[model samples]
Target: MPYPLLHAKAALDELKLAARSAPGIMVGVTIATTALANVPGMGDAKANWNSLAKALEVEYPNLIGNAVFLSRAGWIADDREAFLNAASVFSGDLQKLSGLCYTMEGQVDQVRDAYALYWMEIGLLAATVLGYLLACQAMKLTPHLRAAGEILLARLTLLTNAMIAQKTKVLYGFLAVAGGTLATSSQSLGQLFNIQPTESAAINFERAVIPTDPPSVYLAPKRELPARPKQQQR
Candidate 1:
């Protein structure tokens, strides 16, 4: 398998793992929100939980689906090195995205009571910390998703352009071969019948120039005709 494909597969695997683990993260978030609601004046934490849940349930999955589609589309990497480089970056971004769910779960698990007289203060502080972490992760997530998209687009463009160039070369090669065969056959038939073969601009253009070679080398040689006989007295 090509390196680009390998990296793409790794990225897709990470995305799948993240998607599979999201429901578990959601459960942890729900528990954390429940605990926070039991304390007085933790509305902000609950709001944050709602936002995070929406991301996990809706936005994250949508992004993953897009990534999967792009990755599959970009599987035929004409520029292997460039594609591999882009795929590696995307793979790293995907790993970070997948790790977010685990990180969030860990943070949620740490919402225990401090059991001090300032327990309310401690709970609020914990909520603040968790909220801050969640916010940071959210910020990072958006950019990583955007980067993944850009990388895929760039590689796809490269692949597309390369394919077009290759196909054009092949088409030109086929035309050159067909034109030569036709010209040779026509000349042979013209000779057998003792007739002059006609030439056309299109056939001349097809036979004379090869796009891949230097024009000077492929141009037909100019032949000097025998000196015309001096005009006889009429």
Candidate 2:
């Protein structure tokens, strides 16, 4: 019912609140998006998700983030915007950086590690793009269409969370590899000038997870995809 962006902003605001208090905790929040929030006879999926989130928030303390409609819509819109603006640039950067890192890796172990790291990075990025596109298609559904796009969006939310978790792992690998590369480059530069290389800062960050409720919680009962418009006989 709400503009996808507004829903997305609310979700981010919630996460920011959680982050401020429990800076160390990484929450896997989930949210459901449905136009049928107030519809009767059909399932009241949104309310159920809110209740679940509240329960989890209380039970898990800082471990569980609230996964409600706002957050789910917010994530989808935000990711779509990101892909629109920087997906191409980011993809290029990853390719270039991965190639550079691979060249720098000398030992067999280093080569293997770099290969695995880059492979996963590229794979995850591709997955992220595909997920975003799916979300886009789902969000475009109108009342004229019987199928609920929110249901598809709900499923994509789970996939997106998984991609985020994988990205975190790849990010940690990048920091380590980049740090070593910088250190190696620094040492080479320092040796030429008879100066010592500075120590690189250790990079450590917890992976963020944003999980959501199941599709049934977001989809309406008796929902069917909208049929194609039939041509009138002339």
Candidate 3:
């Protein structure tokens, strides 16, 4: 098996694990978003929550597409070195994505803490002061979520393009090998039969006349010229 296929299989396995684990994380995000939306003073933060949700929606399908492509056996690296380079890039992207997930998780925790604090402060502070504080926290928390979501989308796009490029390289390599094999086999068979193949008439004709020659002497012009000079001497 190709090294790239092996790497893809490993990636697929990791993706499977991620798929299993994702719902729990998504549930947390959903709950947090819902909780924040209900909180009275979230203001423009609600739009950010909606944007994050839409980003996640787009991200899940892209992840699924990555898995689908990786599962394909045809997307192979041409050599061990190629596989190593691809694997390095893929691993780095995965690490970046993992870091973003961790960051998002921390952001979610912050939102939860803010939610809890809202209730605590509500009891002691005036309505106007409490609303202002909640709005301020929303302003800080929502931007981080949006940025992380955008980064995740970009990483997924890169991964998808990398897989496609690997597959294309493998396909071209296969075609080159096939063409070489066919030419070699044809030459071997010709030698074994002691058969010399003549050039096709079209090829012979093309070689017989230079493009600079007049059209009247286009056919075998060199042979025609020698015979014409002999007849004139006679």
Best by lDDT: 2
For model 3, the run of ten residues with the poorest summed lDDT? 28-37
- What candidate 3 gets wrong by more than 4 Å, as runs, is 1-78, 124-234
What lDDT does each candidate get? 0.42, 0.43, 0.42
Shift in Å, residue 23, candidate 1 = 39
Which prediction has the highest TM-score against the true structure?
Answer: 2
Backbone clash pairs for candidate 2 read: 8-74, 28-209, 30-67, 30-211, 30-212, 31-67, 31-68, 146-226, 147-225
lDDT of 3 at 78: 51
Candidate with better TM-score, 1 vs 2? 2
Model 1, 1-234: lDDT tens digits are: 544334333433432333242322232222222222232222334345446645655676567667655766544345555665765665555455444533433333222111111233323433443443344345446866656554543443344334334433544455466556546644643454464346642355455765555456554556898999999999
Per-residue CA lDDT of model 3 for 162-206, tens digit only, reads 433444354445546654654664465355457445656335555
Better structure of 2 and 3 per lDDT: 2
Model 1: CA > 4 A from native: 1-142, 195-234
lDDT of 2 by residue, 1-234 (tens): 433334434444443343343332123232212111222211233334345444433443332223232244545665756644564454444444443333333322343344344334434444454545445464555664325564554455455446545555564666577668758754653454564444564333365456666665564456688999999989
TM-score of each: 0.23, 0.24, 0.23
